[model samples]
Target: MPLILFNKPFQVLCQFTPQEGRESLADYLSIPGIYPAGRLDADSEGLMLLTDDGKLQHKIAHPDHKEAKTYLVQVDGAIDAAALARLQAPLDLGDFVTKPSKAVRIAEPDWLWPRNPPIRERADKPTSWVAITLEEGKNRQVRRMTAAVGFPTLRLVRSSIGPFSLATHPLMPGDFIEVPANAIHK
Candidate 1:
């Protein structure tokens, strides 16, 4: 089975499972047999891989594969180089330390679509943006990392995973495109 790259929209559930009043992938995707290789929280949005192939699913989701996932994070506080450096360093998250990851400050793009139920803004406080990449898919890792550095994440978006990128795809919120099975291996 081939793989599909989906730009998951905010508030949309990552799976076909019914969420009572909440929206799900079944609302946007009609392709049969394909299941999400991994999940993105409904509060976050961006690139997600789906496929009918079990091996490919394991390859993408299994920690042993070490596939890189990158994210663009909007944080509550102004991020500095020192803060970014701490994000890059292994974070002692109590249970276990996070793996080393890349983090950098970046300017916000005007092209970004307005998120539904827009993030809260404070007159006295400002926010900044950063890009971070990790090979491990720990639950809420990016959010945890940012908070650990004293900048809580306000908005988060997965920008890329392995060879697939949201930048190259014409996906708007809730849109998806299928790629050849071979593309998954590349």
Candidate 2:
């Protein structure tokens, strides 16, 4: 079977196994044997790939592959040039130093769905959207990066992984479609 492009919703666990009071992939996916190639935290949302092929899974999940993962982030405060520069520069995250990433201010995505609980907005503080691309995955990296720079991430969505993108294969939350593994590498 080919890989699956899943639009993972916020608060959904990456694994298929049941968790106490947490929604898992098994709740949405009935297909057997397929598993997520990479993880997206329950607090985050967007495109994720599931496959049964071990080689393809490794290619997608391995840090050595340096697959570009893109995120649409909504932050608690307006991001200034300095913050953008910090985001684009190598970040020291205590345990590891992150590679330089692409960070740019972006207008709110019109195509995005309204997050179920919605991000909390402060009446006095302004919020901004940023498009950030990371070459490597880290535990809560984007959230930590933004907070480290003084602007905490309020909402995060993974819009792409490697060559696969939500734009190329549009899926609403909880929807998925099958695609050839070769298409992901192309």
Candidate 3:
């Protein structure tokens, strides 16, 4: 099985196909017969897994499998204990209620790379960092969750999926490495 770990940069579409004047995965990767196991939106920067194995792809991407994905978020306001509690509890998202998730305030990671078009800054307001681990990957779920809690996310980065993580195998944007398929078992 060919398993690839890719660091997706901001503004790149998650698909391999060409889009109208926007960059896609095809611009960064030309490997044939492999597709993204899960998608990260064009606005979110993060780690993405791609593979040729259909079964493995389904197992990784399907919400029923409950694969844990960790994200480092920069929100617009200074996070507080009450906000963290609400994030950890089951909160209604209007369309659907989210499952209880792991959320904690964290210091901004020192190793994070600067985004090309930096997030807007306001001198009057403050921004804080949070680490959130979710079992399901709903569309724009992280952004919605933060916004619901009164801390709109300014920047988002997926730091890990299941057993693989950028903390252990750091890759720059648009860079990729084929890891052993068996590494997923650990």
- Best model number under lDDT: 3
lDDT of 1 by residue, 1-186 (tens): 879999999999988978899999999999999999888998999999999999989999999996799999999989999999999999987777998999999898555677888999998998998989999877888998899889999999998999998877757888888888788678
Q: Lowest-scoring 10 consecutive residues by lDDT in candidate 3? A: 177-186
**Higher-lDDT candidate of 1 and 3:** 3
Q: What ranking of all candidate models by TM-score puts the best one first?
A: 3, 2, 1
Candidate 1 structure lDDT: 0.89
Least well predicted 10-residue stretch by lDDT in candidate 2: 58-67
Model 3 agreement with the true structure over 53-123: per-residue lDDT tens digits? 98889989988885799999999989999999999998789999999999999999988899989999999
Per-residue lDDT tens digits for candidate 2, residues 1-186, read 679999999999999989999999999999888989989999999999999998989988998886899999999888999999999999898998889999999999988999999887679999999999999989899999999898999999999998888987888999999988888678
Q: Choose 2 or 3, whichever is better by TM-score.
A: 3
User: Of the pair 1 and 2, which is ahead by TM-score?
Assistant: 2
**In model 1, where do residues sit more than 4 Å from their true spots?**
none
lDDT (Cα atoms) of all candidates against the true structure: 0.89, 0.92, 0.93
Lowest lDDT sum, 10 consecutive residues, model 1, at: 108-117
Query: How far off is residue 93 in model 1, in Å?
Result: 1.2
- The better-scoring model by lDDT among 2 and 3 is 3
